[model samples]
Target: MSLVDLIARADERGLAASGLACLDRCVPLLGGDDEVLRPLWSSLADGGADGDAWGERLAKARAELDCADPSADTVPGLGPDPASGSGSGAETETEAETEAAVSDEDRAAALARRMLATAPGDPCASALRAWADACSAAALQIHRLLDVAADGDGPLVAAERRRQVAVLELLAGRGAGGLRPALEVSTEGRRVLRAVVSRRARGRS
Candidate 1:
């Protein structure tokens, strides 16, 4: 099923088959190198008391699936070349490997899981959901601001000018939330748009 469906099912059934399906997709979707996958996997490893009963078997499954520790250097196929037992093989790390090595999203997922585990009620879910939402909003806001700056002071100019300072603040990393960094990075994009338009406007005037 889709990710949203899987999450909903898991909520209803406490890690039901659908949830497992969602988890199964995580490796491919996040890619094997995603650091965020680790915490999700960890949260699973922490498992409900019931899954914990399966113990080592569950752990083995997680490892085999490549969701156990995305940051692990033992990636399949990327390992030492068999013939290169000669030790002369190029040891370049692929983008996938690099991503897996540092999946920052992992920590956020883990924190959400821990909070959810303690109180499976609306309060816990809402709090974590808010964090995710905030991150998404910050990212989107950055996009809008950049678009306005890039396209010039057109229809968006008025609205952008109003929110311009707020957008700048977000890019400066003054905001606090799960998605703050992403918002911050988006700032550079806004900067590009602002500079281009502002320069053009000045020349015209």
Candidate 2:
């Protein structure tokens, strides 16, 4: 099924996991460690959306990551990175070239931060649906901003889209059992994002 259909059909746990997976994969942009979101995951495994653990963990994560509560548009109207289409992610050979590259990264980071900030403290089914949908959009955009393929989405964005689907499918098919594999899928994507961030930093330098 399409991602929209999968999300619409998902239960509370599935919805929460879907959104968390997206945010977890984008943690690299927030400069957070790999395990920063683990607590929230654990809360899910131990009944996250139904308790205070998710909220506490989310709060702690925001503080630890130093996610500033700034309004969106950190790069004002900085929309999709052209890299997702015909632009390239490897054009930073000088300060002048780095300007646009840095702006894309900054905007990507801003989107990531907003995902964390907007996550609901009470994670109800109603609230989680919106959060999940927003996370999906933000994560996809972040990947698009960082994507380097010359033709289309490139490997990075393509893989991210696939992983998002896989996470939802896992949750849909396996129920709670899917959480483990969904997390695993997200971890693999996180590693990919971290590598991209590292490569981009070196390239800009």
Candidate 3:
């Protein structure tokens, strides 16, 4: 099915299931660390940096995942390399103000721009970028469905979409070679997501 059709079906179903499935499919297709790393690393080189709260939140999330599964590695958005050199996880109070939260729309736009820029360069790069754009657009739509679920709509649909995104990410070949950390970050999200989908599929209420 088309991404939009999958999204619509997910929305009609529920949150915790459908949305998660979409992400499984989407992230691999459009999301990952190394791609973001280049831009983020460049941005840092450009003198922009993240804050303490941001780092701490990431650290904490990583720690929690680590405790649950020692084998997992950090995802791109949450993974910060100390070797890149800025400082400890601590952010200056002012830095906190400057570091904006990563929004779904912002990510999607960035992907679209990257896709456009990369498409003319090389065949593989163009393909990857195009896939990324598609995934990002799909993610934004899924995020909207999640917003609806948060407002008391279809939880199962939300879950399914998320899973689909993640799965698509894997299928797109972006999720390979990062088994440990990917598994860690994706475990809980995947678990909850699957449960929701399975329940819904079984016609549970």
**Which one wins on lDDT?**
2
Candidate 1 lDDT tens digits, 103-174: 223322332222122221222334333322322322233233334355544544444333333333332333
By summed lDDT, the worst window of 10 consecutive residues in model 1 runs over: 112-121
Give the per-residue lDDT of model 2 (tens digit) for 1-205.
9989888999999999999999999999988899999999999999857799988888899899886452332332354323224335444356345455567788788788878877888768988988898788889888988899655678888898899999999999998899999999999999999999999999989
Better of 1 and 2 by lDDT: 2
Q: Which tens-of-lDDT digit does each residue in 1-205 have in candidate 3?
A: 6544433332111221222222342232232322322232232223222323322332332233222232222222222223224346776655554345654334433332332222111223333333333444444444443343655436545554454455444433332332323333345553553343345446634
Clashes of each: 3, 0, 56
Give the Cα error of residue 77 in candidate 1, in Å.
25
Query: How displaced is residue 82 in candidate 2, in Å?
Result: 20
Runs of candidate 2 with Cα error greater than 4 angstroms are 68-102
**Predicted structure 3: clash tally:** 56
lDDT of 1 at 163: 36
Task: State how far residue 75 of model 3 sits from its true place (Å).
Answer: 29
